[model samples]
Target: MKEESQTIRTKLAKIRFFSPEGFFVCAAIITVIFVAMEALGLRSSVAVLAGASPGAGAPATLGMACLYLLGYLAFVVLAPIFVMGSIFLLLVNLITGIFRRQQRHF
Candidate 1:
């Protein structure tokens, strides 16, 4: 159990923002955040973005809507890009590694 837990910790520690795995993790986090907010009924707050009064207070609702909009937009736009980026980076790394091994054999 201890060894397994330590290995999990080490794997988590290996993820950095600039790495492919880290990008996937970041995308996952962003998607989870968006899902949580949606589950909490924050999606209605987005009505403020369309000039509709979904709640009593315009300013407060608008602010919340704006914040939610930013997060939603980030998830919609950035998450897919991050996933693609991770795949692209993984492929590039694999190709380079293969070439390096071939060169060493020659």
Candidate 2:
């Protein structure tokens, strides 16, 4: 029984939400790219989010531009949100690992 409990505790410590972490990291990277495009004067491409440029008053030609910009902003925000969520999960996993390790030590 002791050996079996030890094995279980060690196994639990290695477990993690690896898939979600990978996805969030990827999304964050993509967001950074979109932000870069917006920075480099690619407004039209970034305006696809809100579908309109109500605040900027960029004119009809820039409508699409504004929409794309909004899109980029949305993605940028979402990426961080996802990354944060992943980080939270990581913390939870770490906590559980620690608990299991402590339990096994006895």
Candidate 3:
């Protein structure tokens, strides 16, 4: 039992996700996305919907622009929520598996 506990601890340590290297890689990805958005001049759509630019409709409001921005933000927010939810589900499954296996041993 002691050996099994040590093995699990070692496996957790080796996952590397908690390391500084992994953190910086994720930060770099986020930075790149922001830079690309600025370069592409795509931020105007979000600004208009958020009412940063009310005169953006002076020529004629497309209405589609705000819809696109809403969709984009919804997708961006939902992606991480979905990913985290899946990770939580995976951890729950792992814990349940361990408990079931231990019960079988008894």
**Candidate that scores best on TM-score:** 1
lDDT of 3 by residue, 1-106 (tens): 9999999878655645433433433444545565565566655655565567765654333354554455455446644554555566567768999999999999
Better of 1 and 2 by TM-score: 1
Model 1 alpha-carbon miss at residue 76, Å: 1.0
**How does candidate 1 fare on TM-score?**
0.84
Q: Across residues 1-106, which tens digit of lDDT does each residue of candidate 2 receive?
A: 9999999877655544364556566566668777776676667443434545344454654665755656676686767777877778778879999999999999
Clash pairs (backbone) in predicted model 1: none
Residue 88 displacement in candidate 3 (angstroms): 0.6
Candidate 2 lDDT score relative to the true structure: 0.66
Question: Estimated TM-score per prediction?
Answer: 0.84, 0.51, 0.44
- Tell me the lDDT of candidate 1: 0.88
Could you give candidate 1's per-residue lDDT for residues 1-106 as a string of tens digits?
9999999989988888887898899899899999998988888887766667647457889787878998899899999999999999999989999999999999
Instruction: Evaluate residue 42 in candidate 1 and report its C-alpha lDDT on the 0 to 100 scale.
Output: 86
lDDT (C-alpha, whole model) for all candidates: 0.88, 0.66, 0.58
Error of 2 at 31 (Å): 2.5
